[model samples]
Target: MARNAEALDLVELLPRYGLENYKPNIEINLFGRLYSAPIAIAPMGMPGMVWPGGEEIFAKASHKARIPFTLSTAAGATIERITELAPDTTWFQLYRMPHNNLEMNFDLVKRAKSTGVHVLILTLDVPARTKRPRELRNQLTIPYKPGLHTLIDVLPHPGWMLALARHGHNSFANYKKYTNKKLSGYELAKFARQRSGGTFSWKEVSQFRDAWPGPLVVKGILHPNDAEKAVSVGVDGVVVSNHGGRQLEGAPATVDVLPAVVNAIGKEATILFDSGIRSGLDVVRVMALGAKAALSGRPFMYGLGALGVQGADHVVNYYTEEISAAMRQIGVHNIQECNNIVIRHENALKF
Candidate 1:
């Protein structure tokens, strides 16, 4: 994760002289609709760990901002509830359930279609959970065991405690109906992981494309060949990511391989980007390299952790202002003009 962030920081946006007279229009068309900007809140599982009702908070904020909000299948909020909150702006990300002949997984897809999610994102990155050294070192386990050490760690944040008290504990609300008994935290995590058999095949993606009525996107693509394969499978878009550098330690940064992926399949399919997008400037950097839009996860999480519900809107506004300012600085009047802007990528991969 740190490597991803560091790699993005190395990309320098070269400023252009003059061209600041016209006010830049940062709007973009995504999922066949116009949005306020090219920024969207990327899907994150267990966001409630940062703030209670985190998914709902982002959904409301994105709706207000006129941008997209993607909900993870393992999110603490349910599909119906989030779609209700942001009917026009909501997107759904799904994980493959290889259990029971994929009955439950197909059910989730059906539910997303019925609920009217604008886009269906099939996440293909997590072949299996990788070792998180920080979590392992901290000995952090879900369904957090109640003890003095845990209490000591949590007691400093009274706001979080009060939020928990009011909203209750977070769980995989989307998958809750599948089990006979109530499960939250670790047990729910285990159940979902077991069902999420991982690394979807192109054939499976094609199956999902046929089943979903709306636009379909395949996330976790890093290689140009994989991007080509995803386009061939009839996906409407592809998210170029390395699972935020969490799944594979040696994987190249998404920015480094973005140009290659775009060259391989940009004409045939929309290429969205994820992993290590920290600012509106970072959004512009990817746009220059040929991403249709930039989906960010960690920056919004940081906002929520600091400011709770207000943080979502705060981040959205910040990105809006920054993207506009950056565009003007780079001599662009709109998102399309960004394609012509000059960028100095010191760390781009040579492939």
Candidate 2:
């Protein structure tokens, strides 16, 4: 019965099954670099808090899966450390700093390039650190204050506590050498606000394009006109995102806006989509609309929080298998074939 149920679910979810049959290939080329799959891991900040050495684990999984893994600016591990773990698979995502620290941020990009990162993803959405009420409730702020509440919370989770102990003081290790400010929970928030881009504009993006030699991808674009502007400013790609809806409450799903963004950019710029992508069918749906690739943030983080590195591996494999099955059922051989597939929505009034 379970097998029957699973089969029915697949058939119902994927109706692009019969018009024409072809295999789906997920390979993608970005600025002369080839990737084995059109899927890339979106940058998740402070993965270490969720799992012991989470960044390295994800990097290894990406290398094994032959997909790109982006390291967040606020990642627990330094850029150099992540690159060392997955030399060929690393991409760097930068959160542009304040104007006063702009040169320092640019220097950081050069440093990332020096460490062998090929792709530089510039995150332009964070005007200020949006309140994450959950973090506040859990007392999971930066520079982790080991308060009685936090200690009590972790007491039941001995394994995670032990791993945290072994990992040792895990504050953004990358920035410690530069600033003497030790970032604790609220302090981390304050520090981020201090350094983050509040006035970042397209002019800054153009400057970054001229400064950085590698492929530049601007993330956090949700509008078609913004995508067009990005291309005009000489960006190589635009990641269609609403910052996983963490930044705003009522932003449209990345899937819904993907087609317009792709059309606006035309074929000259690469269009990647993210936000609320929970399954393989979601990936297929967005790609069909016009995304060159699809990336997810929270799903992988859930896997990491649940099973550490092994959890990360399981999540990637789950997506790969799901995508493969979707291709076979849809009768598409590769990504290109899948791109030509379409879906029709029928009215629900039935006798």
- lDDT scores in order: 0.87, 0.75
Q: Looking at model 1, report the run of 10 residues with the lowest lDDT sum.
A: 137-146
**Worst window of 10 by summed lDDT in candidate 2:** 1-10
TM-scores for every candidate against the unseen true structure: 0.95, 0.87
lDDT of 1: 0.87
Task: Give the residue spans of candidate 1 off by over 4 A.
Answer: 181-187
Please, what are the lDDT tens digits per residue for candidate 2 over residues 55-92? 88889898888788999887878888888878888999
- Among the numbered candidates, top lDDT falls to 1
What lDDT is reached at residue 82 by model 1?
Answer: 96
